[model samples]
Target chain A: MSATTAVPTTAGRRPMRGLGALTASEARLFLRDVGSVVFAVLFPALLVVGVGYALPGMRDPIEGMGAPWDGHLAIQLYIPIALSLAVATVALSTLPTQIVTARELGVLRRISTTPMRPQGVLIAQVVVNLGVLVLASLLALVAAALAFGLPAPQSPAVAALAFLVGAAATAGVGLLIAALVRKASAAGGIGMMVYFPMLFFAGMWTPGPLMPDTVAAIAQFTPLGALSQALTAAWFTGEFPALQLVVMVAYIVVLYPLAAKLFRWQ
Target chain B: MTTVVQVENLRKSYGAKVAVADVSFAVERGEIFGILGRNGAGKTTSVETLAGLRRADGGSVRVLGVDPRKDPQAIRTVVGVQLQEARLPARITVIEALHLFASFYPDPADPEELLGMLGLTEHRGKQFAKLSGGLKQRLSIALALVGNPQVAILDELTTGLDPQARREVWDLVERVRDSGVTIILVTHFMDEAERLCDRLVVIDEGRVVAAGSPAELIRGGNDERTFRMRLPDGAADQFDLIGSLADVHTVIAVEDEVEVTGSTHVLPAVILALAESGIVPDEIRTMTRTLEDVFVDVTGHAPEEELAA
Candidate 1:
């Protein structure tokens, strides 16, 4: 029953002040959230390193061409693939889990109450995930180039385009998963179940084209199949598929907005 | 004063289950209006609609004169919300959480001032998971107020606080109200509602069963008032001496436990007589009817009555 403090009059201002502020705040939160940071950057880099080390001693299906499997070319080939996996893991696992956890924790629920747009929230996730994916991909590439004598890419533009396409496609798929699953535990499982299979099928371990006819046909149609094809063609053969790029772009255009629409803040 | 929040026949249902049915209430500028109900009584659902979290199947809601469904984003900037069920990332530190939430607002309260006000200045650097429940709750409160909002929505404001912590929260809430920020309090604790809210709405089974000031509702129930006395040890016979005094209607005693039922006019006289007799009870308190009693009368249970039953 003590005297109340002075009332401030600040509500006369406009809503949706500026995305820059929100984006900065979200970025800070993402960095402050140590688990998300590791998941986005450190974990993916570790995975790429593990895959690179594990691959050098194994049989290379396309090694007959003397393409130098452990050199920069092979490792550069992994730049896009590693980035793709990183993107998928980030959008699928990190975004969905955060959304679900936000809902459970009432963060989303509270956010829903404010003038903050659901779109802002989605944009924040994409921004954070994109940062993670880019940083992780860079770290992995630098490590591979320095430590294992991984090959540098023949075409930087092709490699960059391929990485962007792969990241967008992965983000779309991740959004779809987040929209469909509202609970953190369920979303985590779905994200892993859906993305890990894509990794194995996308030539992360076994080349997709060398697989049995049935396996190759099925893999070709999956989203990951297109990504693997795009990256493999760009890095290994110096050949980029315009059609595959178009298809990847199409996947992004369709899934990104769809996820945004269905994404619940609460 | 103009109403800061208005709801008309707000309805929300999930599949076949109606979570909130025709719940409507208004909160004036700068008043703490509590929504009192047990769990599953549609308190959360009702607040969600007002906050634009859940789409109401029927009716409409307006906060700061904006339709939440049509302009959820616009509404969010003007109102701060502290949901009962959620938490920030476990790794997030207290000051970090404050800064993060404050970033959403064009003009936000100072994070340092917010921490100081909430008594979280000491734990500003602690990670969210490491904080105690009361500390977490306080952080959430700080987050909700960071936007420098004209209105604040809080669910289960003091559900898990120890007495001292609860008092601290109550003080903070009072401070928020003083800031001219309209508040919507969703809780089942009648005492909390009585102590915090200027007016309240009670819900049961997704329907609003009562709405009024706490005093009016308590008076409307017309419940019998009781005088309770805890006498000193070996003072069992003191009840007999007090029970026979003038205006004392019914004196019931079992061992040292004593309860006197009478009109408000007579209870004080009896207590005064007891004090005059040189046999003062260890603890003497008048039992007035509360919102809890009214809930039981109207909804057939006490505040925590549902869970207890």
Candidate 2:
């Protein structure tokens, strides 16, 4: 038997010291997963480049659009849509699956035994996924700007804020999925069910002013729809999408607390 | 022998189904205490309360001088838990897990030393999903000890291991106890509790039915002794005579042999009675009741003894 080490007194112990290490380890694991990385980080960039180059007539000027919408290439509408696709893939699919799997495998229950609070574990998860979302969105933005001649964000600060609120709303939906589902496999299926619909409302099928008025009214309330609207307006028209930002913020306010209350660690 | 953990009449229920009715136990410092029981026998519930993972409906639980429910933060810092079936992410390497868990504590044990202690040094770079069952269990124990906890609760640590692997884990647990951290081993294996625990409480059907050292529980306060003996060729006439003896309780002919159950002196008395009939039984095997027998006697269920070597 080896000699026992000295026992440190419990005075002034920091339980949350592991938060940084926990987040770092989670981030490393997330990167190691090639599938999650490709879908969450690199896929958006691929979408931008693929649609801009392979699809015919993407860079051609529009004919019927007037004033602010006049002379815009067809590919200009895709930048925000691609960004929405990235958020949907990560927040709806990858994030929820990881959380539910960890829960089912007792990872969260194991953390409960440590000095760190269980809430720290959830926070670490959200932070890692959020970091990945930001990277993916930026990669897509750069890809569109360089490849498709997409204009830079006219109101850069507002666009950045809009992107954040939209990401939070999407993450909120993922958190709710994680809270309701008990199985990891089921989480993926359920995420996909929500993913396709959200992408539709984000204007993946119909870009900008081409969408019907009734659909636009309904889509503005959806997280991805609001994000696409905000990103497109701020990028092209240089106008703050105040309604879209408020809608996304409302989704976050409702979804985040609801998910937290329903979240099951074990 | 200071008591580091004390539970008094702990009671808990999930909705209408009661998980723990009444349970109490005190764990002394530096001892490998056991909460032995069958599955769904309130063992997990009791320990979960001590770890502050579950709250008891009624009863007091004090871990290291702090109530687990009232001062959950204090309990978490001092006590560590390796939950049953709890696993790490499939892609996380062994070393990364140790370092991550170590950071959860104020003063943690060296991760390198823990790897060596748990015999996982060579497999440090292996992902969690690639490790064998025994290796996964060893890593779980290593993580439990990495925080330098004052007390560690290991729930069903070796439930899914081969005999050799189980023994290896048993040795590791003893080594952990030798390092001066008190262990509360919750298990369903009779031999595991018998071999590892200094003192154990046997729980059955959500209640503690027996509690003591293995030897004491086996002894069972003047328990009956049983022995089986083969009668000499065609000498069946002496079986009833043995049962009729003063000290003997019941004698039944089982197949070719006569099984006798009686007082502590039954074995010698039966032999004497057989000798009086001028029949010397060729084989007489005296049965010493084990914890298995005691468990059956108390819980009224067949003991779930391991058939491993």
Candidate 3:
């Protein structure tokens, strides 16, 4: 062999540089899964469109309520509930399953052999899932405003903040579930175990003013419930719901690093 | 030739499991080095240490003159590894996987060139789940070489592949070596080791049982002639003349096997003596000791005793 053909085994490239390509690759993979797309992105809009057209009572003004809550329609309240479902679906159902499946396939181990850290894959996962959650939220909001003659969110910035922190809080829980699972089946099973009950508290079955007073008081303590209340509070009141944001941030603070500590590479 | 990988007295264990009790080898630049052993042997553990996937409980490993334990991060840049049972996501396309892994290196081989070179160009758009075992292996090898490392470690490259696919992968390995990258191949298949390895260490039950080229191991120590034959049902007596020949040393007949051990020219002498008696043996296999026999001779067990893990 000539001197020009001599191999130069480097220590690897810049560590952070691989993240963009990694996220793009993961995004493409995520887009290929029909199950993830249907449940994460389309389901929330389906909830908005289906409920608006199917249940005419939802588009009418909510009755039997007085003061500031009087003018809001049942459909308006269902929109935030649908948004909660959006974040929960991807964060709980899609995120954990994807992570545990990659672990089962030894993707983490394979990535570790490169110059990039395995943590890059985790960061990419978070970024992709969070981006999907945001998209799902906006799709639900836009569908409600365009189809039902609902106005724009009273405070768009506050709504966005609620979406991010709310989605992150739920994603943190999904990471913890992924960290605890050894197989994709187990991830799906455990994610389901945590999913439906959380949705129950988030008022998927009971919109604002429709839920019992005691149930609403109880839902404030749960992650998705806090998210639902936060989004609802941001929309009608046009203010940052400080207590709801704190509750969501608390979940992120406690769950995310714990998931990282417990992450299983293979 | 220069030594790019040097390992000495490597030892690793999971609690009391003792996965690698004692192991060592040196790999020359631009040669395919084999770590030959059966499943449950220390072959995987030893390479895992060299690749910096595992820390040795004892001993030292240096890949490209850098110690893996002290600086595992440094080794990752210099050595590209295709780990046993390691796989890409099922939905990832072949081309996407190559491009994705290429992003991890400062200087990477062209993805298109790697695809064409590995015979995966047509399968570039195929999802990983849709590829055949051979195609998946080709993609795995492409990912390993994508980083343009000086050394590539491929563990169990053809474990689940068919014979034809196995041969194709072996040919690919040779071509890769021809490109000037040193390869460390870990496999349980004796034929794979003999066909591709320039030099190898035979690991058995977490220890080095033998070390040399396949030919050297077959030639064995002291260069003695040993041959085995199978005779007709009642032709055991035919060994009487061949045993007494001037060049012959010993003949042992047991069941269907008639084995002869002797000095030079003994094979031809025995054949000539057998021909004179109007005796024709059903089968005669001469002086050919494959890696299987070498393994048994050293480890006191067949190489296929354990399941392929």
- The deviation in Å at residue B156 for candidate 3 is 0.9
**Model 1 over residues A1-266: C-alpha lDDT tens digits?**
11112222335555554456556756776787677677778865676567666667422334543543333334445555666677677767887776666666656555555545556665666677677777887886676667555555566688678777766787678778878786889989998898788876676765523446676556655677667767766666677667667777888888978977886665
Q: Which candidate has the highest TM-score of all? A: 2
Better of 2 and 3 by DockQ: 2
- Tell me which residue pairs clash in candidate 2: none
B1-309 in candidate 3: lDDT tens per residue?
888889999999999899999998899888999998888898988998888889899998877778788777778877889888887898999999999999887778999999999999999999999999899999999999998989999999988888889889999999999998999999888888899999999998899989999999988774568788887766677766787898889999766788898886778888788878777778987767788888888888887733223
* Tens-digit lDDT string for candidate 3 (A102-135): 8898999899888788888888987888788878
Shift in Å, residue A92, candidate 3: 0.8
lDDT of 1 at B53: 72
Ranking by DockQ: 2, 3, 1
Q: What is the TM-score of chain A alone in each candidate?
A: 0.79, 0.92, 0.90
lDDT of 2 by residue, B1-309 (tens): 788889999999999999999998888889999998778889999999999999999989888877778778777877889989998999999999999999998878999999999999999999999999999999999988888888999999998788899999999999999998999999988888889999999887778889888889988675688999987778876756886899899988888888899988898888887788788998988877777777788889976665543
TM-score of chain B of each: 0.82, 0.91, 0.89
The runs of at least 3 residues in candidate 1 whose Cα sits more than 4 Å from the true structure, single-residue gaps closed, are A1-18, A25-80, A147-158, A207-217, A240-243, A246-250, A253-262, B1-3, B6-12, B22-26, B55-74, B206-208, B221-287, B305-309
On DockQ, the leading prediction is 2
Candidate 1 chain A weakest ten by summed lDDT? A1-10
Q: Score the docking of each candidate (DockQ).
A: 0.31, 0.47, 0.45
lDDT of each: 0.74, 0.87, 0.86
